[model samples]
Target: MSHTIIVGIDGSDNAQCALKWAISHAQKTDSQIRLISAYTVPGVNMSQADIVYPADFDAAVKKTIEDTAEAAAASVTEAGVPVSTTIVPGDASGVMVEHSKTADLAVVGARGRGGFAGRLLGSVALAMPAHSHCPTVVIPSTWPTRVMPDAPLPIDLPVRASGARTAEADGRDRPDFSGEIVAAVDPFETDTPVLRAAAAQAAIYGTPLRLVGVTATHILAPEWMPSEDHLVKMYDEAAKSFDAAVESLRADFPDLEVRYSIFDAPATEVLVSATYTADLAVIGSRGRGGFVSTILGSTSQGVLSHAVCPVRVVRVTRRQPGRRR
Candidate 1:
């Protein structure tokens, strides 16, 4: 059961950035890097008029994928790390998600052709983190360059090593997340599933949870009246619901630490700023303005694109309610 870091590559500038970040991290952790590039075949029914170079399409596509993978491998090798490349044929997001289930950590770029138009299109990156069998890391294109000056990289953090144990072994100070977990809450209605997910992560990390509720007032501002009090009241009610949700989590995880906060700004800004010094930031995929068909909302997209540290976006799925005995 050796752990490997899987990175999704598409040969784009952003994807290249993700590959570089993954390679450096994999080297430091002594983990093998799996560079994957997926290519989709064009539909058979599409008119030849719409197609370009249909004669050599398959071969060209295969060559492109192989070349991209080789280039990625070469980049890592140049940095003195061993890496393996794989070229798979299928839908990009779906194939990446399937691979993510077995990977120790999956890394992907924040924006790409497969991503959303206006938001971080890192669907494959974000999806794996939400439902992966292992922990995942979504690397933004703007990551800071590696700080290694002159040294062979260290091995990966051992499996089953507790944070405290790792810190003690390294003689390095543990990060203080006692201040707040900063859970972003939607004002329209409190999503219980989202809160529960956030609480679980906070407890695992041993950080105090802070519930933050944000309301958008401009949408409902009537030109004649133009009062923001209605929105404030909505936020207040949502805050109360958030508090109640935290209480429920406390009952389940009795020893869990929790708190609450409220904000009147845009959800994205609130969540992004909250992640500045916080150990982890948690937010829901959908909110008041969420589209029924989308897996992520505008706020989530923004946070994933710009957050300073790791950000977890809770994805709500339908399941049978727990039976009370």
Candidate 2:
């Protein structure tokens, strides 16, 4: 089965960044790209002394949206990837979520033109990850500037690392793997779909899988906590669990590098810190035991908001290893 990556394009530079990421991932996974754009028509009530659009107004707006999708698809096609386009009339986030039902993955920018200035994420970016049927990847608009400062803007271009091969020199399109794939590991929930998704992404990128476990000792402390002994015990327990998980993943992915870390800090602080050197940060939409939920809790929100690299939020329960669809 061919996996389809849904990319929400609103003709914004940020959305272009999302499209570039989708195209790159599609090339690596041998998947198809589905570019989508949504638009809404203002309500016109003839009952009031009010305004009404011309008969062709709606048609013209839809045609423009279709043209935009076509142009984006043409770019993806030129990149040698299977590509298609969908232009619908509705709210952008809702439209994308509706299409996500049949998609294997969804990608969007951290912020869009629809949001007000100073907002870290747009409404669509904020809503899709939590609502999408499949795993959703939100790319930061400043990603290119942060991770690939030297690369061209608003396009898919591999960063040239010291020991990495460049497409121009190797005559092959290869993704940059100088960074690691960081996955948030919940000590309470050792085995989760988030881990599986992160492992798959690590395999896809050919990067190291870093399992990060955070224990909020102070935050979870009792009102009359006596000493640091209890906190130390909690940290020790988390470390062991993280180590075991790392070994398990290493055995499962023999060819891939697997490592683990335990941080006695807030979940958001540690996870966001990991993203500094990560190719992608994967987190669960819900948290049961310790780490804050990505959607329901503030930790995931903080990481997604401030992460320098792209973040993938997984909400589904069982995931097939190494399979995006």
**Which candidate should be chosen as best, given TM-score against the real structure?**
2
Report the lDDT of model 1 for residue 34: 83
| TM-score for candidate 2, residues paired by index | 0.82
List of clashing residue pairs for candidate 2: none
lDDT of 1 by residue, 248-284 (tens): 6756779887766554555565566555446557665
Error of 1 at 90 (Å): 3.9
User: Worst lDDT window (10 residues) for model 1?
Assistant: 157-166
lDDT of 1 at 295: 52
lDDT tens digits, residues 1-325, model 2?
8899999987778888888999999999999999888888878678985786899998998888787788899999999999888877778888888999999999999887642112666788778777889889989887666653233212122111113222331353432333778788775445567877898899989888777766555475477763667666766677677666656666567787776666555677667656655688998777655565435467667777877788999874322232222
Root-mean-square deviation per candidate: 11.2, 8.4
- For each candidate, the alpha-carbon lDDT, in order, equals 0.60, 0.72
lDDT of 1 at 142: 52
